[model samples]
Target: MNRKRSRGKNPWRCSHRYPLRRRRRATPGRSRGDPAVDPEDPEQDPDDGNAPPSDDDEDDDEAGPVVTTTHRRFDYPPPVPRMPRETLEMLHYDQFWITYVGTRYRHPALPDDWDMTVEISIPDEFGSRQNIHVRHAPTRRNSHEAAISDAAREALTTLCHAHREDMAITSRRYYPCRSVERLDAWIANPEAEQNPRLESTIEYLATLNTDYNAALDELDMVRYENRKLRAWVAHGVEPAEEEPVEDPADAPRRKKARYNDPEARTYIRHHED
Candidate 1:
């Protein structure tokens, strides 16, 4: 009877109203089935609408047009190998005597007299073709001759022993036929001076000779400059100004005056007819 119940109105109602209803969340198994309603789809985002498609999406979209990117790897070749060093061959030679001509003197420090003319062929480890010459003659007294003699004797003994050993070893070892033949020839014919090993040894020694000559040339140049500088300092004169003078006859002569008489030129008078 509150104002006559309408046919469509309900009799029961709440005094305070509840909040607005929220949309039902999508279930784990159920979907809205509408493509436009699917919020998980990337196309639904307005910012991503115009963005470029990812590789995965592009691959999924096309079936025939396969996009493949090829990467090329480069490899560098290894460096070249170096050649090995050659092994040295041993050699033997017969004993030969040599004469030396020089002075002999004795030092106060020496127990015995020293001789400079002692000639001995010492064996070299490098080869038998090489020879070393030693000369010892002290000009002053109280020289270290004893010590030098001891050292020289020890060196000579060692050299001789080593030479014998090397010869024995070489005899047991292999040697080039040509080289041996040349050695035999040299031993047989003393005057026919030709060495088979000479060519190779000379080639090797040429490099050393070139270096030695270069050093000598440099030393000579330095010595010449030093001498020139010393001479200049001693004389207290510049080298550039020391020019030779010409002879008196070759020098230019000055003009001479011509006189009619000897007494007339002694006095010069004013002109009077």
Candidate 2:
């Protein structure tokens, strides 16, 4: 009975060995007689093949040159007008007052009202001396304003007088010719040419070289003497007899230099003897 048994087939084994096939992808417009595309082709377009490329897809060319623009307007305010030459000279002299007296008297909080005065003197080559007075007004408010104001007014009046005197000195140094003919004659004179230093001095005086004069006059008598001494030394000239140098050995030696000794004087006398 076993030999005659019919061959039996395993349906589960056959189904496991042969799995179900996947469905093929459908091509667009293929059914309407359009050409079908090969899915694996490199030149294929994804979107109906008619749309233009987007910015992200476009290739970048070389970078363009940079351009710049500029404006020429001024950034600061205009400069203030400068005072006239005469006014400037006056101001310069007045500035001295501000420097010396004003700084000393000016209030710490508000220094606008600080009264100041400065006197300046200058001597020319011709042995004439000129005096200049300078004054400044107080720009601040204080308890002593009235007194300061009175003093400032007086100083200003004195300054005016001094200025006039300075002008006179300048004028006297270089007297203007009465006529052009006279000026020409003076210029043509051989003596004038020969004395160039005097001519130059006169020219400087006529121009009222206030700054130069002031600078030269800044030296006091002591400074002048010192300068003269230095010049003489440079030229190998000896100083006058009035100026003396003490010999080291001859200088008086100290004798009983006690501060509070009652007999210090007597002791000193005995030491000298």
Candidate 2 accuracy as TM-score: 0.16
lDDT of 2 by residue, 15-80 (tens): 111111222234454431121222236687433322222223322211111111111111112111
Backbone clash numbers for all candidates listed: 0, 6
Distance from true location, Cα of 180 in model 1, Å:
35
- Name model 2 segments beyond 4 Å from true: 1-100, 104-113, 123-156, 162-273
Among all windows of ten consecutive residues in candidate 1, which has the lowest summed lDDT? 79-88
TM-score for each candidate, following the candidate numbering: 0.17, 0.16
- Where does model 1 exceed 4 Å of error? 1-199, 237-273
Whole-model lDDT per candidate: 0.26, 0.27
Best by lDDT: 2
The candidate scoring highest on TM-score is: 1
